[model samples]
Target: MTSLVRSIWGEPEERKLLFKIDFFVLSFVCLQYFSNYLDRANLTNAYVSGMKEALGMTGHDFNNVNSMFTVGYTIAQIPQNLLLQVIPARILFPVNTLIWGCLTMVTAAATHVRHLYVIRFFQGMAEASTFVGAHYIMGSWYKDSELGTRGAIFSSSAQIATIFSGVLQGFIQVPLAVFIVSWLQRPSTKNLDQLHGIAGFRWLFIICGLITVPIAIYGFIFFPDTPETTTAKYFTEEVGLAFILFCVP
Candidate 1:
C-alpha cells in the first residue's frame, strides 16, 4: 500500500507536505468560496421569497441593484489582485471575508431599495478578492502538475453553494409557510408579535451572514499565504524550503 501510494503521489515526505498544504490552504479557500456564493445567491432567493413586496420594489429596481454589485466587483478586482503582491494573503483574505460577512448581515436590515443598493455594492467589493485570490494562492502552493485538479476543486465549491442556497431556502420556507398559514386562521392576534415580523428573505441574509464570519476567522488563523512567507506552524521552515526547491525549474 505504501509503495503504491508513493508511486502515485511521490515520496512520503513530499506527500505529507502536500497533505498539509491541502488541509490548511485549499480547504479554507474552498470553504471561503462556498460562503461567498451562498451570500451572493441569497439575494435572489430573498427577492423572490418576499423582499420585492416588503420593500415595494418594482421592475428594473432589482436589475439596478445587481448592476451596483457588479460595478463594485469590477472596479475592485484589479486593485485587490495587485494588493496581493504586497499584503499577505492571511491578512487580506480574512479581512475581505469579514467585510462581506458584515455587509451580508446588514442586508437583513435594509428598509429601502437604496439600502440594498449600497450594501450589495460594498459586498461586491469585499468579495472581489475570493475567486481570483484563491487561484493565486493555489498557484503559490501547488506545482504545475498538481494545480489543475486543485483549481477545479476550488471552482466547484461555487456551484455546490448555488445549489445549496436554494435547498436551504426551501427548508426554511416550507415549515414557516405552514406555520404562517395556520396562524392566520386563528381567532387571536395574541403571540403574533412574537414572530417579530421578520420576513423569510431577511432570515436568509441573516443566516448566510452568520455562516460567513467564522470562515474569516479560520482563514486568519490557518491560511498559509505563500510557502515563502507562511507563518503556519505546521508548515515549518524545512518543509517550506523543500517545497520551494521542488518548484524551481
Candidate 2:
C-alpha cells in the first residue's frame, strides 16, 4: 500500500512534505472557500426568508446590493492579488477572512437596506482574495501532477457549501416558524417573532460569520505561505528547500 501510494504521489521524503502541505495548505483553502460560499448562500436565503419585509427592501434594491458587492469584488481583485507579491499569504489571507467574517456578522445588525448595500460591498472586497489566492497558494505548493486534484478538491468545497446552506436554512427556518406559529396561537407573553431580538435571517448571517472567524484564526496560525518563505513549524528547512528544488524546471 505504501509503495503504491508513493508511486502515485512521490518518493518517501517528497510524500512526507506533500502530506504536510496538503494538511495545512489545502485544508485551509477548502475551509475558507466553504465559508465564502456559506456567507453568500446565507445572504440570498436571508433575503427570501425575511430580509425583504424586515428591511423594507423596495424594487431593485436586492439587485443593487448584489451589484455593489460585485463592484467592490472587482475593484479589489487586482489589488488584493498584487498584495500577495509583497505581503505574506499567511498574513493577507487570514486578515481578509477576518474582515469578511466581521462584515458577515455586521449584516445581522443592519436596520436598513442601505446598510446591507454597504456591508455587502465591503464583504465582497474582503472575499475577493479567496478564490484567486487559493489558486495562487496551490500553484506555489503543488507540482503539476498534484495541482489538478487539489484544485478540484478546493473548488468542490463551494458546491458542498451551497448544498449544505439549503439544508442548514431549512433546519433553522422550519423549527423557528413552527415555534412562532405555536406561540402566536397560544397568546404567549414572550415575543416569538425574533429570537433574542434577532430575526431568523439575521441569525443565519451570525451563524455563518461565527463559522468563518475561526477558520481565519486557524489560517493565521497554520498557513505555510509558499515553499520559499514558509514559516510553518511542520516543514523543516531541508524539506522546504527540497520542495522548492523539486518544483523548479
RMSD of each: 5.5, 5.4
Please write out the lDDT profile of model 1 over residues 1-249, one tens digit for every residue. Answer: 334433454477777888998899999999999999998899898888888988999999999999999999999999999999999999999999999988998998899999999998998899998999899899888889999999999999999999988876775576443453454434433322213576778867877888899999999988888877887787675454565456444
TM-score of 1: 0.87
Local error of candidate 1 at 51, Å? 0.4
Write down the lDDT that model 2 would get. Answer: 0.84
Q: Candidate 2 on 19-114: residue-level lDDT in tens?
A: 888999999999999999998888888888899999999899999999999999999999999999999999999999999999999998999999
Q: What is the lDDT of residue 224 in candidate 1?
A: 82
CA lDDT, candidate 2, residue 24: 93
Q: Each candidate's TM vs. the true structure?
A: 0.87, 0.87
